[model samples]
Target: MAEYTTSKPEWAPEKDDENKFACGVMSGIDGITDTTVGNLNPALKNGTMKPKRKMVLSVDDYIKGVSSGDRVTLARAITLIESNNPKHFRKAQQVLQGLLPKTGKALRIGITGVPGAGKSTTIEAFGNMLCDMGHRVAVLAVDPTSSVTRGSILGDKTRMGTLSRREEAFIRPSPAGGTLGGVARKSRETMLLCEAAGYDIILVETVGVGQSETTVRSMVDFFMLIVLTGAGDELQGIKKGIMELADAIVVNKADGDNLLKAKVARAEYERMIEFIRPATEGWRTHAYLASAYKKTGLKELWDVIRAFEKVTHESGVFKRRRDSQLLDWVHSMIDEHLHNLFFDDPVVLGRMPEIREAVLKGVISPTQAVAELIHIFDVQRATQRHVDLFHPENQK
Candidate 1:
């Protein structure tokens, strides 16, 4: 009996890991009396085993799971939204349609800054604080893709070690997927899903690249620009366009030796902010100092955000902006739809290579080449419409 004692599974990563799953023993193939036992087992002949299929969730399943605040279902629904497959697109749209009534109630905040500005650290610290205050926070971190491999590390969840472990926080680091500004194209849809899943605060952390600030600002109620001290002459270029879009400019790393520098930077930003127009109606933009590593000044930051929300809501700017965003979202979807339909047309595909070569070789100007492509694309569409209008099936 001692010789037959249970041993650790061979596949366990650790020798003493009690969580390792136990492997079940299979019965040998009996000659004729019980041929079904082990007869279909691939392991008996060293053949490849059949891979397990993932469970398919219907649109109703997604709606039910998300309505009940089920994290697994929320994640699955998000994956469906991110899918490029047509079937998934239809199903995800249906799910979103069903969950639409539950969305748009969350406070949507967008955070953007340059690289090394402690955006992830700030989000984690801030998120933990929010959770401590009994708030459900959803962090949508846009991860940039590698230029060579086109793959994203999606490291935001791992970076927010404490917040990711919190039951009240949901952190999703989605790949940019080659979209401009490193913002995921499906991020807006995912935010709605989180809202439907009962997250009251939606934090969107941009990739801090080109156009991300504007993109995030378009989607969120409050936009924050996180900066570091010692910006000096380098601040000249960055302080123009994006600064006008920020409701708050936070000078982070305000701890230890950097505290004084942070204060000075905040003052400088405040002075410069005076020259720029406010990002939102009936609100004044200001700069503050904070230290995400020390978890200091974050509560004040939250207070400022709440004040902004209250002021904006009272002034009717909040509802107006949301209405505008909804309309703009519709326009963008229409543009994307037409863009795909245009490029996917076989006539356009056939002419694109030649026109591109012409522009490259200087046979035609870039503008002229674009004009020619548009001309052909328009003609192709017209011809197809005419044919469809008179087709035998249509006549019947």
Candidate 2:
């Protein structure tokens, strides 16, 4: 047999040949026509190896997980507390009850600024600096929720890219959920949980709402406001109440063309703060200038915070404030529980429709309706106690 050679005619389909579809010169510049690839790795033949199913954690498991500084567990614990569900709420409370002793050890700092005032940028620089100093930093950045949809903007982590990737740093962006202070309803509890997880520095970023300043002040050991230059004194003048709440204020974006303006703003703030009582006892509030983009003034800001902390601690105001805050938390919780109970109580629910109708029809005054509702509530409580004391099953 003759060996195959070019003596064989070069095969070419005719113009009208049906087989021409399968014959064509390779076009290197042709765009990708399909996404087909060869077989996947054999190890993933049945299915890609998935993470193990998370084990159901007990209260003790949650406590131990947080104490050991497990980020996954810490995040899950926060979610548990943030839940509005009753069962999760109970479990979250139990977790906090067990971890209370470990809390109040961290420096709680609240940071706020107007929209576009570079809050997330400053936080990234500040948090990265702290992490480099061998400190564990946890950032709870509260994002505003949409009034109509109740959804969050939730892009803080995206802005703090460098710090978010650091091992010693943890960033959690939580929705404000209509909370007044720009802090979420569970923010204080979440901070306590982070403290138990051994974070030495906790930075809470508010939603930048005007009223949030006072609310943040109530919950944090130190409150710092980041303000921008070139916005004129009008913004500052309008926010005097917020200014009075700050332990310190930093004029951010102090580089480029804004440097001089920043210096002037810093001076103006210092003079304005002089007349107001200092937020922290035994410490004077100060304003400094910074460029988060250039990473300047951060060290000075940290120094001022340390000075405030030291002075307050020495004056015993630190402990006193913590005690006062704990009392406030108790009262706030009581009020919230009472509010829920009022609407959920069987007697209140049964009579509310009639009372509301009567009030609307002018048959009873609003105040009278309220008094009548209180009377019904008292009567129901008395009846419940009597049943608990005499009921056959309850006796056992």
Candidate 3:
């Protein structure tokens, strides 16, 4: 054994230093890597992935999507319009500003009826007929949500299986989300998107709940109410307000054994409609019978819609009505936003418990409690404004 010595290798310290230096370089690189890599998780250096920031879609991007006829973008745009967030609200307004010129060109028809009235079947036939005539059609069906889950079945697509498969037709089912109206919160915006997408005919299908008829009526140029024949009530049980809003009443399911019954129902509805006020000047409210499943009388229905559109467009009533509706929508949205904000104030929310207790204990009347709560909110808002005005640091 030629002097088997246990001497440490001379390069051992150098090798150890090199390994340590390599580790240090890697650590340093990682420390600055997030800034260089772009959108990297800050927590990677701290042993976890950071949460991603939600994308803030720009108004320009949204307008481009609308102009480009991108359906997914249109859906997202409507979501933005319906959002209660201040940022999204402002962004949606900007998008609408860009799209205002392109909208109001399509014929908006609102169709509604009570459940089991064959509204979906009628809409399918109506949409297919429009498509056959070389026109693009969009059908928006608003489904009421289940009270337990607050989620709508959103099964309008299933009911409209035929129309859903059409290339020229776009069918969207939106949850009513407990909105009092049959239409969804951003349905008006969705209509604008459809119009921008080159749909000449837009049909708004409301919930068959009867309560939403007025809401749906106010949004469309033409309103058609579909009723079944066997009800025997004719227009008596029908709300006068709803009858007063209809441009036309259609008695569906007129084929097979129900033809005579449908005719009788139509005659009854026609007579009753005559007693109610007309929806527009020079346009008499008409009632007709049809079998949507059999595709009978759809042409006649289209003819009626066309006649109304022609008259309204030529008389300039269409443009005026659309403009007025736009204004009404603006005011309505403002009122809704203000109502939500007023009730959402921390001061108001915080006082609700105490206010309820006081009312229960008879220490204060409900009316007085409300007044006091309003006063508290007013003071809180005034203080916030004062602070915002005087705080130079905050202004900076």
| lDDT score at residue 115, model 2, on the 0-100 scale | 81
Tell me the tens digit of each residue's lDDT in model 1 across 234-293: 255254488889899899999999998888888888888888889999999999889999
Candidate 2 vs candidate 3, TM-score winner: 2
Candidates 1 and 2: which is better by TM-score?
1
Candidate 1 collision pairs = none
To one decimal, what is the Cα RMSD in angstroms of model 2 from the true structure? 13.6
Once fitted onto the true fold, the runs of candidate 3 whose alpha carbons sit more than 4 angstroms away are: 1-58, 379-396
**1 versus 3: better lDDT goes to:** 1
My TM-score estimates for the predictions, one after another, are: 0.82, 0.81, 0.79
- Provide the global lDDT of candidate 1 against the true structure: 0.82
Clash count for each candidate, listed in order shown: 0, 0, 0
Return the top candidate by TM-score. 1
RMSD of every candidate to native, in Å, equals 9.5, 13.6, 13.9
Give Cα distance to truth, residue 66, candidate 2, Å: 1.0
